[model samples]
Target: MALLLLFASPLTLAFTLEDLKNQLSQPAVVTGPFIQEKHLRALPQPLQSKGRFVLARDHGLLWLLQTPLRQDYRITAKGIARRDLSGWQTLPSTSAATEQNRLFFAVLQGDSSGLQRDFDLDLTGEPQHWQLRLTPRSLLLKQVFTHIDISGARFVERIELHETQGDRTLLRMPESTSAESLDDAERNDFAE
Candidate 1:
């Protein structure tokens, strides 16, 4: 019975919110291809876009779209910016956009404490596979999103946004790999 108890101890271990945060935060940089689907209430089909993303723990995210049309976006603490012929042009940050950016950063960076300010987070499953549900706690956030569902194994694999008006946005990072640091090009993009 003592041997059996010892073997079962690992199986009985509970995976908590803090464990999830630590697991996600372990990677300094993650690069992957993504598929984003925007489901509008009035549209018959969702709008799909393919892109590659670079997420750096200390800096920001670089969203480089390759299909349909090529566009590059850099999201940092200041705001969102787009790449053009001249240079990186900062986009106007509406309240909704700003909030969305903050939420995205929080989710990707494993900032559960920061998320608790405006959301009631429900986390489930083990470290290898987990699902997180975020319900809006603030009135402002409640007005825009009904709930947000995020799931992953080690890193964030998918994010689904359920909007108030029956619109939904699905982002899937199907293939992601961790890196020690960003390349020179990615580093330069963040600097700009």
Candidate 2:
């Protein structure tokens, strides 16, 4: 039947990792709302939190959380800083954290070749729509994240983080653009 054929075709289709690598190679800045669902193995239900993320290639990363409580975290080449409704605090960038930050920056910069050494990557779906799965090969990263799944086309659609503690957070990217430059404040807020 025609209907059966349509369903069967989709079930048998798959995307390769090379396809996903190519999709992520494009240059762009992505900013959007993100919903982080933290599922703990011991918890009865997953805790949901909402936030927004701004990522610029030359800049850094700005993560603003508006749900559960108001908070903001910025990661840049300088380091990672967090601010609550009250005040701002800077956190030391451990070697491990620096490595993680570099990894993220490298990926966003479209240096997929650099990432290959650190992650076992696999791609699925089609070029227009696909998922990139990155499993950390380093012992330090393996201790933190089990794997990271990124889905999207030329721009990232969503990022799913699977932690070693069995907690998973899903971040959805809704809006994105390419910028020639960012202001000083935006640069400071998103440095790494």
lDDT of 1 by residue, 145-165 (tens): 999999999899999999998
lDDT of 2 by residue, 28-145 (tens): 4566677877788888988988877777665578888999988898777887789855555788878878887887766655456777888988767686677778899988779989
Model 1 residue 7 lDDT score? 94
All candidates' lDDT scores? 0.92, 0.73
Error of 2 at 107 (Å): 4.4
RMSD of 1: 2.2
Give every collision pair in model 2: 15-125, 17-123, 60-190, 76-191, 76-192, 77-191, 77-192
Q: Looking at model 1, report the run of 10 residues with the lowest lDDT sum.
A: 10-19
Query: How much is 74 displaced in model 2, in angstroms?
Result: 1.8
| Stretches > 4 Å off in candidate 1 | 1-12
